[model samples]
Target chain A: MANYLKLYPIPEDYRFHRGGQISQGLLAYETWGTLNEDQSNALLILTGLSADSHAARHGEHDTAGWWDYMIGPGKAIDTDQWFVICASSLGSCKGSTGPCSPNPKTGQPYRFDFPDLCLEDIANTSVLLCQSLGIEQLQAVIGPSMGGMSALALILNHKNYTRHLVHIASGMASPPFSTAIRSLQREAILKDENFNQGYYSATNWPEEGMKFARKIGMLSYRSAKEWNDRFPRSLKKVPQHPFGIEFPVESYLEHHANQFIHKFDPISYLYLSRAMDWFNGHQYGTPRGANPLNDISLHSALVVGAETDLLFPVDLQRELHHLLLDSGVDSELIVTDSIQGHDAFLVDQQTFSQLVGDYLSASAV
Target chain B: MANYLKLYPIPEDYRFHRGGQISQGLLAYETWGTLNEDQSNALLILTGLSADSHAARHGEHDTAGWWDYMIGPGKAIDTDQWFVICASSLGSCKGSTGPCSPNPKTGQPYRFDFPDLCLEDIANTSVLLCQSLGIEQLQAVIGPSMGGMSALALILNHKNYTRHLVHIASGMASPPFSTAIRSLQREAILKDENFNQGYYSATNWPEEGMKFARKIGMLSYRSAKEWNDRFPRSLKKVPQHPFGIEFPVESYLEHHANQFIHKFDPISYLYLSRAMDWFNGHQYGTPRGANPLNDISLHSALVVGAETDLLFPVDLQRELHHLLLDSGVDSELIVTDSIQGHDAFLVDQQTFSQLVGDYLSASAV
Candidate 1:
């Protein structure tokens, strides 16, 4: 595979949001289009829980990025008019420093020794990367799912850092339902014998645990309606064993889970998932006796939610829009009738691209 | 604990619906009130997947039954006016002949050697129990959740077995989304090292797998709205370990899972859950070139569903009602606004009791 990923080394002794410091820290990213003379066209794209920095392809030989359909030169993000930068989250395995990364002092994987990761840390590091790139101010910041939480952290931590915000399928903080599902996913991994307290080797990896966790994640990420329409209750084949797959839906989940078990690092997944549960947006303004989103200083904002999003239900996005307006920011909320759930933004390109494309065009300064 | 459970023995070798024979078969059940002279006032109550035959308390020392609130004298079921019989399904562990039972021929637990138990078998055994009790006719048959599916099987297979039907929170067949969730749950247990291919000993039971499966089951049994109301985004305590319970919801799931792990047999759960996935009501009617429900001789039927039910959504019940009406049976559909989800019929007594009581009273012959 041709490498399109770029890395930025942070200055020594970088601090994290929760506590502690890392001797070595790095952020993996990719950029497209041109940084204008005044650097005002810069737009930062943050991603969901498992996404990496490769948001889109840069060359014909490059493997397709996670969001390649929506981020190219003439796509929804439109690199022709905007200098877009997409960064892998700090506590991730996609060419970034995480639990899987080696500790400079010990010459061993940080594993649980890595400091507590927060969406705040991801927001902070991405901002530092922006500064290092000589971009003093951002024209806009686009965040979807977990990335939306990081975007909130970015603007709240550094007021007026961006002019516009595009928040999709995310909330101010995690809800109890999502929290329960995530907790179970983590338990599946930690209880695996092969996990061995984070000392799992390549040959004896926690494959079963990771596959189970990913299956649970897939259940929450997509909508019931989509599955009903796609797989129905049709039998795939006669089951010879008691617990074997019989329905097409079960087979679909197995395929997806097997593909994901080895692609992502288990320890990193644990850290990032916990970070989402710990985030409380109310802390941002509770001390001031107001809504937590009271300080986001964007000139305008566009919030997008889907009717079928079970993980981050559309109501959370509605709440986000309400808070943004109360905080005195010009905000618009769009609730699409997409049937693909929280993952609709990734695959429902026609609807999402037009919605996002129109909003960016209208927000041009 | 005092045993309020009663048992009935099958005469000799009994054939199963899916091609197997049991040398010894027994059904555990409980009854309230008395059978009338003609047995026309006898009513049969079927239960969900995990429930036993103890629908309510018969004595002061007897433990409260799973549906004690709505099954006693002057309650919704009004046992004073009707004799009510509730039977544990044949493939269950609650005092019923199941995989946990010893095979009469080999003096060993049937385990995987047991026949493939279907809802049809449950319906057949319950009907035989009714016959042994000298009941020629029934006033009504009430089934909730899995019991509702068995009720359909009973009326479809026996034809005119009951004069009226009350079905709650069930469907004609399991939907794809539910099949996916149930498949993952079974995988959780089957993947447990301690499970040991159904030969798991008491000392080395698949406790972790069972607990995990129960947690997933709980997620589907209840509604997100109820969880949001009961356990909000409040932190229970600061998580000391990475995967420890951090949110109130996570703690709630853990508590419930621990209480359920050893209460039910894991192998029985696997069989009952798979039976639900394999059922197709259409199969009954396809051979005759008509609706499967066309043979059901009920004078009236009441179908109850909750808007919040994720496992068996309201739409399924609506389809059931439509099918019953199309098959020439008088039917009414009630979509309750209760936030209790699929388990609402067990907990939301006020709504369910009134709905059922009204139907039975009107249909009294």
Candidate 2:
């Protein structure tokens, strides 16, 4: 890996789906390992809701990767054997051109002026990032949750852009329930006084609203079975604040929500959540009942799902797998029994690794 | 049936389990139909989470009931043949003596000064109400959700209080996940600026926070199958506000939350939800592997549950049924296949009514 963080410019006349354009924009990205001389061993990794491009340990300290369990020297998607690139999704606050980014024309932050984004723009931006690095995809693209939606958009639209796709716990589009929950989260932020109609300065954050949204998001990410198994109904032996955490699960949600508020931007979350809701493979001219993989038969894909995931049901993954097979594409579905729900991809790393690793290595041949 | 909403006095020394006691308190109740000559055919009806004593209509109008589907002349628990009583739980805001009720000594609302209540208190208060009505034994005690908890408490403590028991979509104790979600809801309310340590004026509600809690509660009450089935990912043709709803499911939750806020009292909700968490049937001298129905061998019980319920899994209801049978009680269990989750007891009225009605009539004969 040559650089820990890299920035690239977008076209001056670039426009997004919802009628707004940034004359000039910069996207921040991070990469690991070396691209082969022929530029044929590059793997692209897309992220979930609020992660940045730092996908693994950067320097001396054992800094954890979001997917650190599955990506190292001899790990599942071995960084030693394959060059991996991760770009911050467009409209994210993590060193990317977003609502928080300064406007080139007005010499101030875009704030509420940022364009309404869609799933396609996120997919296209990642493609543009790969092109800027002079890399024609050879290895694969891996994504989970919203990232999987991006992977679906990328491969289904670009066809031969990648050789393999690893979609975990995601579907072609956000279903009604998922979209509705996200809408509630956005409403929480919008209704917050500190949000100030997305005009709050860098120091004045919508902390309360973002924290509220994260609490809801955490519950949706995991299963009730898992929570019941992990926590108990008894109150804590020792109390902290006046309003004590009577149950362990409540404490768990509170801790995660607090941690998330420190990192995620309310505006970025609003845009990204909406983008996820708007995703659908059928919308891209691949009519209903037809496979998104029908036009790209050469790409072999691995779809992994958790049986306990209420958000993205295992049946949807099975549906996609069969659709790909019927279209003559080499596709396999792995439905694992896990209480971790949609989060099984991250928690049950060993199983996810073995299935994804074997498929990636086999397809690389 | 006498008074539509009658208030009863509690003894000054009536202390709850958690040591806080109102020197003097009142409980409000309502009833329907005539008690049989011997008062042996009186049916006691308990409610779910936050319902009042009005289980059905009181007058000659098409005025609806929450359980309006299954309780009427020639209906499930046919009011024509039996008397029915619905009492507001001890901590409810509807007509019950709750936190909002004035402190007899201080002439002010109890607020946080109210006792830390338990399911037992709620159950015992109903018994006191019955004693006041000159009823000794009941034909049946039917309850759903939290009401089921109260029924369990009543039968376990007062073994011969009822001739029959009907428990629906509830268990002996609140599971860890349900308690955790409830604890979070409490936190959301308390953390609100308007909540003011549960001292807010009745007119000035913690509207936003309570609405947020209700949204979370509604999601927990129903299953993912119901949500996805009820709504689709289509935005309205004409948008109303900047952040218009992208799915009908959002509108449904918003509407429900609005409705709930208007009727429910937040302070009472806090006490009742906590009381639900503290409910553990085994703690009341019923040891492990010991059925609460042990001494009531003459009582026949019906335990009904929903296969899709993530909150109160059907296995708990099945375990209780088996426990009753082991105690030489004529008990039966009904597990309905429905996507409505714990709410199946409310939605699938025909199935529920037929099963309950058959058992009651057979036991009567």
Candidate 3:
């Protein structure tokens, strides 16, 4: 299993405006494959909501990232050929400096007092992670969903570091659907009696609230047609469970909610979900004043979307692709015909693998 | 204002396998305009989730149904020539027998004790209302979303009553997306501390749960792209809002949630959402087994879908139309381009009105 080691006192002053502030922090990350001597064969992957740095093959038994389908050796990302690194994002719970982490000043969970994070904070932390690993340039920075947002931020904010950017099922900024979903999730947490206005004790946590939040998210991650086809009102002869959720679809959601409650931290889920809602291209300064895309020179950019992805639809991906093309950047837009919805980038391995493999191979030259 | 003289009681003999029993009840509904002496100029309008018999005309002001655009004097249903009757379903809050209604025997709210209601219950109640009103038959039965399901049920269960069926942004039964979304809404209600396992006190009811439930419904009711287009990370001028929700979309949801909490009954919302999840054609003893269309006998059927409807997509509606045609039934399908999404049936009146007018006029001869 991958282990964690924390470096004391980050030298950089961390600035935030969401009430609580952290002067310094450490990052927890994991790596796969091996770095080449030239350090040019490196790829940094970003994670979506409720994900970790376990990008690929964290354990001897072949434990990989949430997107293990696209990141393994001989897989789409082909870790055997290129070194891959992933880090738990800021404001996330997976061994990262987040709301559940001990506050540097108080030595207690930051709780609601944790500073609100933007895509910039996530990109800044990833930059530090790259520096800590002694890597000056990344061959490609790739991410899906919120990770996609972070990847865009990385390329736009630190143009010199990321040569190629691959953002799948994401947007240039936080869209209304993302914000609406996040708002509901946050409200679910805030309204929980045990939440105590984000000050709940460790023992009596808001498990139900977290479950509800996950259920809400599960709806957005998949498409309606897929659900209609997968679990069409056929009453499976399985005896009615005690949960009153008799349908296969209901059972699926229940299972997902239960799994999320067990694996995810309630506070961290809230903070990260909110972080995704806060992502905006305008945060780098007004687009009216500065041409951020014009400033960033990318060797190549690949934007991929799933046909049924209701969260970041193909239209939004097209918007991003058009923006890159308008900026005179080399870019290719591909829409994956998958019913897996927004999670298609992770679930539809064969299609996603082809896209990623082709993009990586083309960008490498 | 429409008022009922006597509230019908659920019969005590009825029993449900889901550990609850629904009392058999009757609904009193009224109509506007004149029913031609031939009784062929009557239109039956079904209500959406949490809607009431007040489908149109709130007062003598001649207000229209929730679908004012398609149900007015010169519009689709053509109230100028057709008598329109909108009835509240049996298990509803607005002057209908529901979980919130007092049990005749126990003299207390039914709570979880309310019997599980299938689509048949709504159709059955509507049939009885039609019979009491002395309408021999309906020229057309129309509804949107859940109302669409009810309309389908009316045609399938009461074949001879309705000559034409118009279902918009809905299908024969509840799809997995509906089940998943409804389950989340149910979870929201169940997780509320004040819910008291559906026996919540009348004073401090589960308002937060209702808000959360409404928010979940709202997400499915609109398209993700529409949300992005309408509320693109543009910060609202409102100063009191926090970071993650500083966008207009967040504010829109907050306002929507608050409105839902104030106007909608929490227990009723849970009941309706659950009923929608439990809707299955197989449960109703339909002769065609899993496929309700095989047994449906209608003079004509018109199915409409909103281009951006995420909950009930155009493809689903198309499938239903195909099924109707495959079953040798006369059917027409139309896709309305509307940013309002699933709620487009209520919002995009002009387009839908024209479609309905053309279809109804063609069927009249």
Candidate 4:
């Protein structure tokens, strides 16, 4: 790992896709391996809802990235061969410019006042970051879930500049069912008295509501079959709870929900979640049943889906594969045999590695 | 239609299985058709979480019940042949005594002070109600979802006293996955600021929390396939809300959630939901791998399940069917073919009525 963990400050004139421009915004990113002589080996990696730039552990920041397993040396996106630059979403709270960040004009946290963000903004900003990094006309891009949406947006804008594309567990837009779930999650957060309409005090956060929202998100992330398999229909030895959460599965969700409060920003969650819901491939003028990457000089692309995924179901992935092939884009689709569902990209690392490893390392970029 | 929407009060000293004792308690009920000269054709119908005694129209109230489609004169239960009586579950707010009712001694609402309830209590209370109605035996018992659990409990205790059983979209106990979902619903209710430790004013209900919980429940009641088929991924033409909900599905859920607040009771939801989680078939001492209805003269049992139901997956229903057959009970398990899922029993009235009508009308008390 060379000139790692860096920030690219975006100037004010570089306005947002929607209204309310950020005078001074920044993108947090971490790069692993050398950027090769021509910089063509650099792979831009994007993340899911709350994932960070730290795609893998490096030096003192010892904390691992959300996609830790996939980006390590000798792993799927081998650091020894490909220069990896994993950038956290522009509106995420993980060191990126977001709701919790200070407003340049007011010098106060933007909170709900933060500029409206969309998927395209994140994708476009990352491309600009690549340009700033002096990486000319370069490498492959890998994204999962929201990251996949951003990858599509990136290729749609910078068509010929990008090569290979790997989109996993995402689609043309957030489906109606998923959008409904997200809206309910936002409702939960908004109903919390402490949420204070997205201006809850940093100290007295809407922890309860945020935790509940995370729990709801967890249901969509994994499938019912996985939960049934992991947690049996038996009571915990501890005497029954007066609150009625004596089952192992309930306990598991509570534990995870608790952990989520400290790490996730409620306002950022609202912004990013809304950003994902607002995204649609048609916004880029891509016609229905038409491939978004057809005009690109992309070498080969891989569209991955989890068979049990309820969020971005496998059917959408199959559609994407067919669309890509019809567009004259060299592409392969892999429906991973996984019960982890939409989260297969994170949980079923082995299958993802098996399906995507050869392709990322196939020397296209 | 005969006597309708009557309340039967229970004297003090009546104790519950979990804890505490309710002194002045009541069970609300409604009946249809004649009980016959011998009182031998009296039928008892139990209910799910939020169901009321108005299982079908009877007198002054005139409004139909949740299962109205299958409970009229020539419907599935056939009021012309058998006297039909549907009683509200003990912990429900529709009519029965619950947490919202005042404490007999304190003159204040029971709130959290209300005694913990279990599924067996609902079963036992209905039996007592039958006895009060001067009926020596129940000709038949029809139960759906949680009502099905109570039905199993009822047969386990009454043995030969009850003649037939029709259980739909339910099982011996709440599965781990369903339990987990219910637990989350409870968490949402508890997390609500206005829940006020379950002491929110009757007029100022914990509307927000209850509505959010209902939205979560609506997800489990139906399958993803049904949602997809019902709500397409098309965007609403009103430009787009800056805050994101631009889909018609969002509008549908928001509308339903708003309606839910006016009807469902938050405290009743919490207490009754726990009642379901606490219920296990083994509590009645039915040996493992042994059918709880075996020791009785159950003429036949029709176990119906939905093909797409996610809450009570069809697998459990299959197991119950096999167990009934093994125990020598003349059981006919009819798995309903529908995309409506757990709510299929409520929505797919034609299919349920067809499967149950033939069996209920085939014999007599």
Candidate 5:
């Protein structure tokens, strides 16, 4: 398949949200459809932690993207009706300048030397990418999961950037439970002997730690109902070893873990995962205790969540919906009865497409 | 504090439910109140996975036990009116013959050489202890969490052993979600380098693995609501390292994990945890495809579960209650609003005490 990724250079001495700066940075992005004459049809798409710029197929020669089913000619976030732009988040390894990217100073990967990353930084960089493309205002900005936090960051920080917002499966702040789980995931990597204080090489990669972290992620990503329906006490095979994969669920987790460990950079994963925990959109409020998202100026906002999502439960979305209303923004909340949990937005194509498509179509009027 | 523990040895040939036999087996136990001349007042207390025989204090000189709030005189179990006996489970390391015990055959810790232990084995061993104590029949058998499985095993296998049962925070079988969590916990221990195939020495103990496992356990034991109320996004301190404990929740988990890692035997944990997953009460059915508990001649059974329990959820208990009713047994299910989750039986003193106390008092008639 053809490579649809396009890199946009960040201007010199770009500052990070937390601290530090990169002299030279790049953001990989892709666009579908065309910018309108007035540049008002641009719909920016912010992504979850591990997603790339490829939201869907650009052409027959291009590979299918993560959100392939939700974005296309007649699909939700329809590219034909609106110019859609998806950027690989800042600090991600997916063709974006990150810990895995070569440091200009030493000609080596930044690794731990990379500045602390935050969702705010991810939002800011996407704004930069949009400006570079000569788009001043977007018709809508859609985000899901980690991207949902980044979308909130964008709207909270750059109030006039988008006329509408579509938030999916995220909370304004990471609850204590979510924070604890992410902290444990980070611990897995840090405790890995092969991690070597973030100096791990290609050969000495912390494969076990990455695999463990991904398994933990998989556990939280979906609901128990889904697993029960998929593999309740069904052993794929008799376990030969004491700690081996006994249940089909174990094998399912092992399969995903193995597939994920080698695909993502460990340090990048650590940074992005921590960024989610540190995110508190309420911090953007003018007064110390005010709801930060209360005053956002938007024509409309659509919040969607899964009934079974353990990570980003529906109550969080309900809170977000009320916050938007309290902030004087027109907002609506849609809860899907999808058993896939936090990951339902990604895999519950039919439900999400219907929700997003209906909202966007109505908003365009 | 007084030593409330009493050890009793198994007869010449003690066979495990799954397979294997031990020539010398030992059980540790503690009791409160007096046994009636006819043993009609005997009340056996089966424990959760990690509990010992000391369910409550024996006297002022004895150390306060895990269930001190629930098992004392005038408390939930009401020792004043019942001869209450609680025993360290057969596969546990609390003063019992377990993986940590010296094998009579090899004169060394059994470790991986220990036979596969099941909840049924734990049930059978508890029966032996009761029989040895000259208690031919019991007024009631109360079990919570892992003990609930053992309690079910007892009723299913030894139908006439007890007149009443109080099942708390467990199910007839481990649901796929609960199994997945436990399977991951075992993986953490097995992967620890210092685990050394269950031959880990005192100095080279798999502390990291055990700590990780316990942290995972703590995550499932309690409710997210409790964590949010207790810790929220409150940080204990500014982290000095990238992955240090920053959130109060992290430190809370760290405190519990550190305390647990050293106290519990890793192999014993592995064996007992797997037993919960492998437990299938239906296997005891006399005819194929019948309710295993259909013929149990119990006077009454009480099933209790927490609404917020992520591990052994209330639905499981509800299912068990329905199954018991279907089996011709008089049973009731009580769902508590306590936010402590699966660990509510241990910590929600007021709620559990009221429930257990009221039921036992009613059952005495």
Candidate 6:
């Protein structure tokens, strides 16, 4: 099980884009394995859009982590050999200071008043977490998907504490395709009459809107081939289900929507997707003025991509590799053939695990 | 506009699966260019899902037909030389007898009473159309997407009709991916609260449901990359638009849906999608079963695929080519590199027109 501890900063002037301010704030994080003397073997993992710090462990049920395959003993990440830490990013819902978190002034959930956050804020808070844990430096930093973007921000914007980087299915900045999908998903949520301008009452959450948004997202997360193979034209025996959707695929979508609503916060999804859309290297003070490939120092990096990933696509990976090579960085690119698409990193565990293991063992960290 | 006159005693009876009978229906068709005395210069063009018999013409408005680029004079199909005829398929919303047509027996629209159609019905009707025009054989039958499927069916079931075939972004039969997408679109309509269970009154149609269905179809019709390029994340400076969607892409979808609802029939969409799913060579009494290559006499065929076509990937085209070769059919396979996805046949008109033109001219009846 993964647990969180909140660290509050001293009162300081914090201004927000939406004409709001927070005097002080609490940051939430979780840790795994054990910190050794000298604190140089720590590895930090950032999470994706709806994920929390509970990346690798189930609570009291003795269940596995969201990324259990990569963090077990003798695994790719090797939890037993190195101390690992993951944090519930700011503006997120899981044990973090976000829209669902209680406001210090009002004693109620911030909701709409939650300030906008960027990757730099996340990286800065992570640095605080490391300092609080008495760690002076990190051996490596790794993340997947959006988490990978966060890791890149930490490596590029923050000091060179991390000696090695492993970013999978991420890019230097948000591509137009990602922005378009996010924009549509956001529209799906906001256009719902039930959204009520993002001020829904506690009892009447916009479940339908959130489900529609998730359905749109599910389209991008998996390959068309996988969908075809898993749920064919075969209709349910009943022909006409109570929901009026006859095909098994519609039922599968409904099931997927329900699960997402149960596990994720609608507001968090909105904020994270927006943050991803707003991600620009130039905004974070990149020397090349937003050209991601032009302004990064990578001592050693491994970039992995999924061949069937329509969302990220292999072209993005190839672009990232070319950028790294042009920047005179020692970077390796690997493409994994999987029908899982964007979710291949999570679903195709064996191949991903082996790829990460081989890359880490071979790299000079 | 190329108008179709209703003719009685359509050469054959359309045998439906549900034991319903539609007897003696006539399909009006138009031909371009000159057919030689031996009737060897005939080229049969198949209509798409909702297209009409007016495939191409030199109309006063200069609006052109749906496939004018491929069938006009000096264009592909070469109106200057080959006699090209495009006929509306049976059970289509456009000019064809469909669910919206009035039932002589009940003095009302067929609606739910319309017979469930199969691919054979479409092919058989096409054969009837050909016979009415005094044509016993075709130089080639060319179609794109659904039209492509119909072309393959024509040669497989009616061996004496088409000697050459060209199928673009189509398959031997509908794959599970196509079926699943169509099923989802169907479910979107059927699940609409106002659907009236496919029994809407003549005056009160479920336009919202139909629009949603079209929106879903549009999503699959184009590639994600194309969408990204076309609709970047540019916020409208003035947010006071009556339409609530903020993003241009969202607005585009709304507009597309509304236009489709105005011109397309909901019942016809459902029927056509179902017919596509039910396409099987075995069901049509073909010797080699549903596999197009297994039991058909294909003299020379040209198969074209769009590089970004998600509905029918290039790999599927390759599979068809391999199958044809293995079955001793002379097949020429060419993949069109376009970002238009399944709709590439329409967008990449110049290249496709040339391909179809060369293929049709080289294969003389």
Top candidate when judged by DockQ against the true structure: 1
lDDT per residue (tens digit) for residues B108-150 in model 4: 8888888888887888888888988898888788888999888
Against the reference, the lDDT scores of all candidates come to: 0.88, 0.80, 0.75, 0.81, 0.88, 0.72
Q: How many backbone clashes does candidate 4 have?
A: 0
Q: What DockQ does candidate 4 score?
A: 0.48
Judge candidate 6 at residue A64 and give its lDDT. Answer: 69
Candidate with more favorable, higher TM-score: 3 or 5: 5
Question: Clashing residue pairs in candidate 5, if any?
Answer: A294-A327
Task: Rank candidates, DockQ, best first.
Answer: 1, 5, 3, 2, 4, 6
Better of 3 and 4 by lDDT: 4
Q: Candidate 3's residue-wise lDDT over B1-365, tens digit each?
A: 44422344434553433445555554646576788888888888888887777666634565455665566567677778888888677767777777788887788988767776666677766776776668888888988888888777777678788888888889767777877778777767766778877777768788777777777888888777577667746677554534344668767877888887757666777667766666654455455454556666677889999888877778778878987897777989898878889877777767777888898888888
Model 5 / residue A266 / CA error / Å? 0.3
lDDT of 3 at A43: 92
Q: What is the lDDT of residue A264 in candidate 3?
A: 75
The superposed Cα distance between candidate 2 and the true structure at residue B360, in angstroms, equals 2.1
Poorest 10 consecutive residues by lDDT, candidate 3 chain A: A2-11
CAPRI-style grade of the A/B interface in model 1:
medium
Q: What value does the TM-score of chain B take for model 6?
A: 0.90
Q: Which predicted model would earn the best TM-score?
A: 5
Task: Enumerate the candidates' DockQ scores in order.
Answer: 0.75, 0.53, 0.62, 0.48, 0.70, 0.31
lDDT by residue (tens digit), candidate 6, A233-332: 4456454533355556667777888788647666777778877765654354455344454555557788899988877788777777777787677889
Q: Write the per-residue lDDT of candidate 4 for residues A67-143, one digit (tens) a residue.
A: 77887788888888888888879989988899889887898889778888888899889989988888876678888
Q: Where does candidate 2 stray beyond 4 Å?
A: A1-3, A58-62, A237-243, A285-293, B1-3, B58-62, B237-244, B285-298, B322-329
Minimum summed lDDT over a 10-residue window in model 1 chain A is located at: A1-10
Put down candidate 1 lDDT per residue, B294-364, tens digits, no spaces. 76788999999999999988879988999999989999999999999999988888998899888888888
Off by over 4 Å in 3: A3-9, A14-24, A58-62, A236-243, A282-291, B3-26, B58-64, B237-245, B282-291
In angstroms and one decimal each, the interface RMSD of every candidate reads 1.1, 2.3, 2.6, 2.0, 1.3, 4.6
lDDT of 2 at B287: 69
